[model samples]
Target: MSDTKNKWHAIALVAGILLIAVNLRVPFTSIAPVLPLIQNAFGLSASALGLLTSLPLLAFAAFSPLSASVARRFGIERTLFGALLVISAGILLRSAGSAWALYAGTILIGTGIALANVLLPGLIKRDFSTKMASMTGAYSITMGAAGAVGSAVIVPLTQSWGWPIALSLLVAAPLLALVVWLPQLKKHEHVNLSGPKQAPTVAVWRSPLAWQVTLFMGLNAMPFYVAVGWLPTILMDHGISPEQAGTVHGTLQLTTAIPGLILAATLRRLKDQKLAAATVSLLTASSLIGLIYAPDYAMLWAAFLGFGSGASMMLGLTFIGLRTKNAGDTAALSGMVQCVGYLMAAAGPLLLGQLHDWTGGWTAPLLITAAISVAGAFTGMLAGRNVQLEHAESSSRTSPAIQSANALTAGERKR
Candidate 1:
């Protein structure tokens, strides 16, 4: 009976994590499909519309590093619960029928998402340390699927019920996540209550390995977001109809969810991920090159890009857990990586857009992104080494408790 109860608790925890993942991407992706409805409703300028769309990413950059510190002080479970409330409020406020509310709400939503994004890996590291790869894959799939569903349905919903109503409906996801997540608060209360007192002081920012992981993740994100922002336009420019381009875009997103399962099943069998990392990065670069050289094969290239991006992202997230000695270090490393990674991601689309304007063509921008992807392959090779951040040179300055924890973790791994 006791064993059965523990198994059920683990199942509940996994369900809760996936439910939160469902909220991670939908709030932003859903807005993309209804952007025209929102712009016309607000009578906004093109620049204003762009800013509205970009606000969440900016919020992500600003809020991500702060989440770990906040979680350390307040406890991850409680902090996450608070984040869901913020998201729910942001959704409703965005649908409040005003420009200020719209931007402000987006910031709130982004804040909540950033918190969840940075912390979830740490949570998995704490509770599911032995299954980090599989858990990361599971949540990644959940996020991608939810984002795809939101993108597919939002336009039709907006047409039927109007933009505000359509936007307001997103609140339901976070609310449902909250209900699913409620059990975790009690289950984790004792650990969380003592978390602040027991947390270690590890200088993840000073670790070279941490930066390598950050760059690997950030570089991979650049091409993916670049594709997200420009792929449809590129397709149309290449003479495809808008309807067909949209279908290809949907195909790209749906394909992104596939590699998560693949990695989950296969990653643990490998001694190290260096080859897997290089393969995915090269795949992305090749696909971008394919898009430029063979526009006729856009669908094939898009699917390849999606698989590469998805696998690379899963690996990055898995690295956070695999490279850390404990949950505290995982949170610290995750925060640092995401703070830099997302800032890089936010800049990709804008930089690509500028390059396109300067060159008056998509070829130059796509080529630049392809070159970046090749560079990412090199960084991924370095980041994929079978070494933990606690053993990095800079960790010599970490607190005694951290060093002790690292020693214990190393000893455990040997057995």
Candidate 2:
């Protein structure tokens, strides 16, 4: 009976994690499908619309690094609960029919998402250390599926009801997540109170391996976001109808969810991820090349691009847990990785757009993204090594007590 109870508890935790993941991407993706309605509602300029879209990425960059410390001070479960409330509030505020509320709400939503993004890997590391890869893949799939659903439904809902009503409906997911996650607070409260008193002393920013992981993830993000922002326009420019281009875009997003299922089943069987990383990078580059040379095969290229991006992202998240010694270090490394990675992602679309303007063509921008994907293959090779960040010489500067604590935690995890 005790064993059965424990198993059910573990299952509940996994459900909670996946439920939170459902909220991670839907809010942001829901906006794109209804952008025109929003713009018209507020009489906003094109620049304002761009800023509205970019605000979330900016908030992610600004708030990501700060999440670890906040989690350290407040328990992770409580912090996440607070984040869901913030997300719900943001959704409501954004739909309140005002421009200031819209921007403020977006920033709030982004800030809440930043906290969740930085902390979830560490939560998995703490609770599901042995099953890190599978758990990462599961949550990645959940996020991708939720985003796809949000994109698909928002336009139809907006047309039927109104933009504000359509947008405000997103609050339901986070509210449900909050209900599903409530039990975790009680379960984790004791652990949080009794866990190591001293925070991680190893500086993730000072470690070379951490930098390699950051760059690998950052480069992967560049091409993925570039495509997300520009692929439909590129397709239309190549003579595809708007409806066909939109279908291809949907295909890209739907296919992204496929890789997480594959990786969840296969990632743990491998000794290291170097080859997997390189393969995904090559797929990304090949897809971009196909897009440039064979515009007629846009659907195939989009599918390939989606699979490559999805796999690369799942690997990057997995690396956060695999490369760290403990949950604290996982949070620290996650913070550093996402802070830099998302900033690069924010810049990617803008830079590609500028390049397109300067060259008066999509070829140059696509080529540049392809080159970055090729570079990511090399960086991924370095990051995919079967090594932990704590073992690095630069990370060895922790005090004797901290070292002993880490060793004890590592031993506990191993057992």
Candidate 3:
């Protein structure tokens, strides 16, 4: 009976995680697949259209800190569950088609997403301390997969149901997540995730490794978001049909999902992450070069792009989990990275677009992106070292019962 109950709990957690993962990318990815139509409908300028595409990411940058704080206060599960409802409202409101309603709903969606994003790693650490790495890997996999679905399904769904119906379909994910997580509300209690023992903010701020990670996380994200936010358009710009293009874009993200799982299973085996970071960065660079200069090899380059993005996101997530010592540190470091890093990412898609507008080609912009990719790996090499934060909370403080309950990852246990 005890074993059955434990298994059920784990299943519930995974289900809730999957639903939350589905919610994470929809507000952002759904926009891109339908962007041109949206722009035409609203009669938005290119800059305004770019903002429409990027608003959620930009809001993620602005709201992650507050999101983290809310999680710290409300308990991650409650924050996640409640935020999902808010997200549902955001999606439905955005469906209603007024300019003010659009911005308002966009903020609600971004705000809810920010809370969900900030709370996840720490909640995983606190609850499934045993399966931290595995669960983190699982979360990352679903993220890419969901992103693929959101982009690829939009036009098809729109064809069948009209754009609003297709787009508002996103609200279902968060509502389902809330239901999956409902039972956990009374069962799991809050742990203080950002307490005083976790050193002052400046101490965390001063760590070179922290800055290195922030850069790695942010820059790596820039490309993926660019792909997520702009890739379909870029492909269409090259003469592919919207459906074929969405499929190709989806394939890239699906590629990201597959390798995320593989890399999750293997990152522990890697001896030097500098090598790991550089290798994936090189893969990403090669893929981009092929993409920019060799459009004929679309399928092949798509695979490479997927592989690189998957590896890069997985590594960044791994480093975030690896570098911190405890839940508080995880929360703090996560807040810093996601807050500043997401803001930086919000710039990538828009920045390259403006450049493309000015230069009359994606060539100059792609070159800049490739440089950023390499730079991410260079910084990741420094951040990915096996060193822990010098002043972060001790890992041993994780309740031993919780430690045993989840079969915590070795590195998670070691801290």
Residues 66-165 of candidate 3: C-alpha lDDT, one tens digit per residue:
7656766676778788788889999998878776777678888987887788678767878788988688778877887887788788889988987778
Best by TM-score: 3
Query: What is the C-alpha lDDT profile of model 2 across 121-208, one tens digit per residue?
Result: 7799888989987898789778877776776676667778888998999999999999999988884442242256445545788888
lDDT by residue (1-415, candidate 1, tens digit) is 9999999998988998998898888887667555545767889654465566567777899987777778877778878888899999999999999989999998999889988877887799888889987898788778877877776676567768988998899999999989988987874332342245335356778888888899999999989977775676677779976456656676677789898777766989988899999999999999999999999999999899999998898889889888888767887787788778888887777777678667878899899999999999999999999998764445566688988999999999999
- lDDT over C-alpha atoms for residue 197 of model 2: 48
Which runs of model 1 end up more than 4 angstroms from their true locations? Answer: 1-15, 36-53, 72-75, 122-135, 162-164, 179-210, 232-247, 264-272, 293-296, 318-333, 356-361, 385-415
For candidate 1, the 10 contiguous residues with the lowest summed lDDT are 189-198
Q: Candidate 3: which stretches are off by over 4 Å? A: 1-10, 194-196, 200-204, 320-333, 384-415
Reference-based lDDT, each prediction:
0.82, 0.82, 0.77
Error of 3 at 101 (Å): 2.8
